[model samples]
Target chain A: MVDREKLYQAILTGDAKSARALTEEALKESVDPKELLDKTLIPAMDEVGRLFETNEYFVPELLISARAMKSALELIKPLLAEKGAEPAGRVAIGTVKGDLHDIGKNLVAAMLEGGGFEVVDLGVDVSPEAFVTAAKDKGASIIALSALLTTTMPAMKKVVAALEEAGIRERVKVMIGGAPITQRYADEIGADGYSDNASGAVALARSLAAKVPAAA
Target chain B: MPVSQPTIPRLEEFLFGHARCPVTCGNHLEIGAGTVIPEVNFTLQAIEICPENWADIREQYSLMIEDLCRRAVELEVPGILFEFETLPPMTVNPAWGLEITEILSETIDRFHQSHGLRAALRLTPNDTRDHRRPPRMRSGPFWEGMVEFLHKAPHAGADLLAIESTGGKEVSDEGLMNADLKKVVFALGVLAPRDMEYLWGEILSACEGTDTVPSGDTACGFANTAMVLADRNMLPKVFAAVIRVASVPRDLVAYRVGARGPSKDCAYEGPYLKALAGVPISMEGRTAACAHLSHVGNIAQAVCDCWSNESVQKVRLLSADAPTVSLEQLAYDCRLMNVAGQSREDARKLRDWLVESDSALDPQAYVLRPDVVLRIASEIAREPTPYLQTRRAARAALREINRAFEEGRLRIPDRERRWLERLAKEAEELPDREEDLIAECLPETSRETFLPEEYGLS
Candidate 1:
């Protein structure tokens, strides 16, 4: 049987190949995919999130660790589906249209995945329709938009309006961030939440994805 | 060391690197802030211009500088900080950067002539990332272009040059503060040492006479700080940007480094200073510069703090890149002492000894105490590190750097020395080479997306 301890170690060290092998081994041994994921995978990712929060880990380490987790997930995903395993939640994220920057969006996607959310990374320069469509198709609980330039920031609001037009505004939470973005901007644009960094993005995803109450 | 006279800089001198006009323009200089040093200054930080908005860009850049200059006199701003942004690739050639600088120079002169307002101008780069180019331009070529740009720039009549990091501000669609080096330079830092050695010399050449670039992954402040402080007129003129003293018995200078403020407004001020213990760092008992005040407030306070006591000694760190620039020859007599390592006292001691030593060098690097560093390395060796990557990369670079020092490849300046020579120097070895070190420590993700060419970040 693939040792749970060994699996955790692989993910923690960001050894994607090892993590995948161990995960498959565990599944082959008839370990409950749900139990293994809940016990090992989620917790390992949670630890990565905590390290990120404390500044113990930065963007590079975070990326590698997330990659490791994602690789292992590739192995476990089908089994989880057959066994009817639900993620912490589902999220769709992308850099808004006319904005080509992707580092921030990529980081948030990694963080979201690490936080146990199934992230639909829409890549950079994504149109509002793309975001809404991803959310609609994936049954996503949240849609995250990012913009760095003040000039490009207006695209975020457009996405929000698009969500309304598509009739998905009620279901999907919209979160925004970037250098020029602020909490005030988030409120002005009517986004559900805002986070300055990736770790905060994960927390926002959880709180946003989990049982969000309707506004008064 | 025989004491040299403190050449107090007039408000005009701080404009050298950041803002400049033809030196011959003299009193005819157009837009500028009023002279108020060791006091206070306000900064209108960001400048974003679209390519189509040609006249609009000039108008906006002027209006902002003029408004700030007006405030400089009214609020008594000690210096002027203009973040000349090169957004949407405003310039097609060297002349474009020069033209923009000339216009800003005229703006400063006009303001000075009309409103009776003038302070040393600090032209810092607030470049937005260029999406048109591939990630990571060649550092050598980018810096070569920058050096040529700066040469054309001196004619613009600027007094201070605050060269920013490699990549300027980037606006992401995702709303995350993701700043990264263009990945191309990553190759230069970790892989190509020869190219870095050439690029390092070029950077030092560019920063020769300028002041106020913060130490970051891209800017190595040791030499630049020394260069500006060594200038008799500039140092004393912008004295407020120097160390502020306190009532504490121990020698305490309230010095602030650059940091993303607590509120994260792309602001800088005493927040970084407030994290330190010295009283002068917390000017007006504040934790950060006013968002409205911008970085100007910090410079004003620090300048005044230093000028508060003229006789106090200072220590300025010289770039050890030059063969003659030895640790023993650096400015040890000055009041500004760079204590880089605080949490790690052992590392601090090692740095101290390197600075203090003058005679025969320790080629083994074992000459200075390296116990604390070795121990830290050992402690983190086997474990999975959640340690900050910048800190991790820095520690790794430092280890290699100390080894370089021990191997007799580098030298530190003496307690009293300054690098004053031709603008360009023969290519030399640099242990803590600015651009290379910055490129090396960048997170892999940042390196992949940001382009050095986009920001003119070399």
Candidate 2:
């Protein structure tokens, strides 16, 4: 059997090569990929998220660990698909239209993927129509919007309004974050959630993802 | 033997009896000496603009400018500098930017022509080339519109040029998050300075054509991003503090290339630029609370040549419109600084207060001290290139933070202690030479985020 501790350490240390090797080794040993993902991978990312919140880990550490986890996950994804496994959630993320800031949104996307969410990154300067279309077509459970400037912050509201216009507001949860964004602003825009950091964004997505089925 | 005070290298070379503008402008109010110039940065309130709402946008600018200029008069302010940072739509349409600039500059000129209230507009068009990483510098609609807006705004009566350029943000964003000294050094040190050389060259040529003063650039997209993340608890304040110092050399690139200062107020690195380059720097502090909250509210003004309220929207408050309120607040801050500037000893005392009030409270605030600034800046000036300068700056700042923590002069929280140690170790571990550092970091960075050719890397 593959040494699970080594795999965990590989992900934690952002050793993508080691993470991939350990996963392939485990799969060859007939250790269930689902078991490996649920018990080892998810737990490792949860710890990474914990360290991020406590300040023990920062963006680079979080990013590399997420990268490692994704590397390991890529090997398992085909296997998991063969088994008909569902993701923790599906999220569509983007920087609002006219705001081309991508780092924060990318960080959140990475963290969500690490947390086992299937992320559909809409990329920067995404329009309201694009977001509405993603929700209907991609079957995204959550729409995450980001904006770095107060000037383009209104675009977040426009996205929320677009969702309402598309008649999908009830089906899709909306969350917003960025430098100029506040909990008050999120509330004003009728976004379902707000988080100031990426690790917190993952936790927010998970909770919002849990609520999505009930709302539907 | 006692250590001597570290004097800034270029202190004696500042123009206009101090670090004021190198050339004359329509604003008659001299920056850097004699009196403090109050610069106000304001935005429109919650209103979206389309072709149909263009007239409403024009009226909004009129209301904002009229309120601010009238408030400056009512307050009996010495002079004012207005920063019209265009929104996306305005920058996308060059004519729109020019129209707004005409409205603002003409009104400020009217105030000057009538009330003798000296003022100038600093036109900062947003850099919209972020659709691609390692942004296409001088091509595409985004780049063309930005160049057009910047080139024409000055001709339309803008007296100054400035921008918070985002050239290196792609790498630096990850660098900041990872708290990787080498990545930040690559991003701010290598990529940003290269972009500034090209960007500021264009700005200088435009200014030369229009007789406009080429003001300085800010690290708002880089350092300030670190700060806001720290403030939001997404990153450690200690790391953010070190990042702020690391950015000084990058911010200094404009001056090395031919741009003159009074650097932008929001570039919290303004004091370092003032100290290292001996140029006038615009700084924002408590009055800037109208725009963003920060711990450097007091220390940011220590070496300020001009005082500014960062940027407030032209919304209504109980007393008046927000921009007018910002003008009143800024005018008062300038009045106090100008009054203190009268006596050398009194000015020192005021500077001491500005430094003392916040320095020990947070590491971010600690590095803003003039003595601390000179110490780190001195180390940075010894470097041969921006990359080495950035490395030296980060190392020197990390050393200061480490010493302050060891001496108990700066109180660091328990959670931040480990990060401080980690940052110090990481900065210390970087190779001194730029090429070696670049080679080591290149393999680690993804090509998807940054282009090697853009930064002149293999």
Candidate 3:
């Protein structure tokens, strides 16, 4: 039997070496890879994310744990894929046109991936047209728009309008997030949802994904 | 689903220019702490100083109007649009009002004389203000002042006048909507149908509420909000509105990237850098501008500290003292570092060469050399306390060297480990003076005052 508790501890402590070794050992012992991921890795990462959101852990700690989780996932990704695994949902994300800030978008992308979503990142200063194109091309169910400037907030509306113009407004749910974006703004823009933080974004994406016909 | 064609070409054109020449493109400006005033002759003076190389100039309304007038008189440059950011009252000391008007008038006078520049001013207001200060006043007084100043400019003056809406601290949708943007436009006294047409829509759109509010502190947040509101046509009247507020330009409007008030803790960097690099400014000026921001300076120093070569170290040391150091010594030091070979023998040869060629090897260089400087300072210093202080200073010096190394800004041998060992030894001895140093170096902020109970160091 594998010491799943120890594995969990390793993940929380960001002990990549120990976590990797223990996870591999568990696999060798006939432990299901999915069980190790679901019961041990994911839960540990979730706690890390919570600690991060609560300010109990700073960037350095979060980065280390994220790195550890990434390494561990690399080893498990193959097995998961071999079993015909799919992400929770597909998301197309970007900072709106004219605004070039990316940290918030990047954090949300990380969290979305962590939450089992395939994220197609359209880098900063992305236009409304780019967002629509990326969503349609990637077959994404959710479009996450981020803006950190009051000046660029209008670009978000333009992007929403572009989506409507492209006839994909109904096909994809639009979720907005950023330092300047708010629930009120989301409502004003007629966006599907708005979240203030990465954790909330993931949860929101997951909830919205469930409502999508294709995702469902 | 049909994929929409990207608007990248428009963005690139707006950003880079039709020719796509980086040097020919307009760049953003960092408006240092200054005042904008509306005056005629002053406006002409401003146009004379306007950097001809720049295409887009972001400034406050007062400055933008002045720049426009100046461009008109001096360069004959037409259609020179200026984005003016409106700031909250709290951010501006009322005492600086006159100064602001002075700067603005001078900028406009120059534009009027040149007949070369057309002008558009975007207003960005600061989102933070102390309620205790005074009741909120919209653009009325400012427009009146601007109109009085523009009346003095020559007829058929600079082309455009556009008002930009900005986010302010503690400003709510209701507060903005209640503020009379129309009255402000009336004060501008630019009753020409074209001017009125431009101003009314912007002001009204700015007055409309948006789902998103200002991020409370970041300039980018206010700028973003303004953009969103403008797009929704919720922004108050445009007869006074200068431009369609957008997040890209707003992120670039700041004295420094992360400075207090009117800057979002997030955003600004990516867009600003992209816009700046796309401009035609000289590399030296660009480097200086980049270093002017604390964040950029810190990153540069961090990179320098990580890797440094002897040549790099020499350049840094020389540059640090260039204002005070002799030119002959600077040249000699440069030559010494440029020489090949690294060993005790090489060091000795360099020392001999220095003695033979120059009166004395620059003491500062020797004082900064990882092995030699520490060894000498340690010998002269009486106790570990001074030694630690000296070590800290040396670390600061070496930090520059390290950055030069990593940036390939200079060429030097990799000696980070040896330097780290020295730093660690110095850190070990730091306990004796740690409290004193912290007291001297760490300034108190509102959040942490270094209370005795917090550190128990008392």
The C-alpha RMSD in Å for every predicted model, in order, reads: 15.9, 3.9, 25.6
Give model 1's DockQ, 2 decimals: 0.25
Residue B445, model 3, lDDT? 16
State residue A58's C-alpha deviation in candidate 1, in Å: 5.2
Worst 10 residues of 1 chain A by lDDT: A207-216
How large is the interface RMSD of each prediction? 12.1, 2.7, 19.3
Q: What DockQ results do all the predictions give, each relative to the true complex?
A: 0.25, 0.46, 0.01
| Over 4 Å off, model 3 | B1-458
The TM-score obtained for chain B of candidate 3 when compared with the true chain B = 0.24
Task: Please write out the lDDT profile of model 3 over residues A9-115, one tens digit for every residue.
Answer: 78777788888888888888978778778888888878877876665544334556666777677778788889988667889999876554555676678777766
lDDT of 1 by residue, B326-427 (tens): 111111211122222212343234334432342123211221122322332332232221112112322333344345445665453231111101000101
* lDDT string, candidate 1, A1-216, tens digits: 568888898878788899999988888888887788789998898887776666455454566788889888887788778878778787888888767566667778888887678888877778899988887787777889988656578789989999999987887889999766899989998999999878888888888876554430
Per-residue error for B291 in candidate 1, Å, reads 7.0
Per-residue alpha-carbon lDDT of candidate 3 for residues B269-345, written as tens digits (9 for 90 to 100): 22222222121111110112211221121111110101001010011233332111222222233233223122435
Output DockQ, candidate 2: 0.46
Candidate 2 regions exceeding 4 Å error are: A1-31, A54-57, A160-171, A179-197, A211-216, B1-24, B456-458
Worst 10 residues of 1 chain B by lDDT: B245-254
